[model samples]
Target: MNIKNRLTKLEQIIRPQQTPLVMIKFEDDWSPEQQQQIDAAEAQGRMILKVVFVGGKQDDNA
Candidate 1:
């Protein structure tokens, strides 16, 4: 299933104590609906976001 579908499915299950967290990595921006879903998940503190730049150079500043 796609990310949206997976998130939607996850939404179907309400588990705050034993909730599943999802880490999403994407190079491009998601649609409004997708963002809403992500925001909702984040409000529940069950999602992590990672932005990947395809072919873009990364600097080690740490």
Candidate 2:
């Protein structure tokens, strides 16, 4: 399913005060801007994110 549809379904299922932890698989490494956005969100305590890349670029501590 597409991200928007999945998110809509999730919104319907989750209750107030509940935050869902979502894991998305990407075809390639994310861009610097994307990482920056995620970092900013984390710094603000808005969300918790951990990215695990596989193969040669794998980063367990990211």
Candidate 3:
């Protein structure tokens, strides 16, 4: 299946009212083009993207 179809299926399983923590990992050396694509996907509002960078240490509050 295509990405849009897969995303739609995921959205059906996860309603808007419900908030879930989502993490997307990318290589530290990701190219600018790759970053732009990620930004564009976020702009589409198809899903929620939370960008958090942690180096070894974890956030206890979470």
Q: Best candidate per lDDT, number? A: 1
User: For model 1, how does the per-residue alpha-carbon lDDT over 1-62 read when each residue is reduced to its tens digit?
Assistant: 88999887787786435355444546367767667777888887774554555676688895
Q: Per-residue alpha-carbon lDDT of model 2 for 4-55, expressed as tens digits?
A: 9998888768833435333343657656766676676667555555566677
Give the TM-scores of the predictions, in the order they appear: 0.37, 0.33, 0.30
Model 1 scores a C-alpha lDDT of: 0.65
Model 1 residue 23 lDDT score: 40
Best by TM-score: 1
Rank the candidate models, highest TM-score first.
1, 2, 3
lDDT at 1 for candidate 3? 100
User: lDDT of candidate 3 vs native?
Assistant: 0.64
After superposition on all C-alphas, the RMSD of every candidate to the true structure, in Å, is 12.9, 13.3, 11.8
Those runs of model 1 whose alpha carbons end farther than 4 Å from true positions after fitting are 1-27, 49-53, 56-62
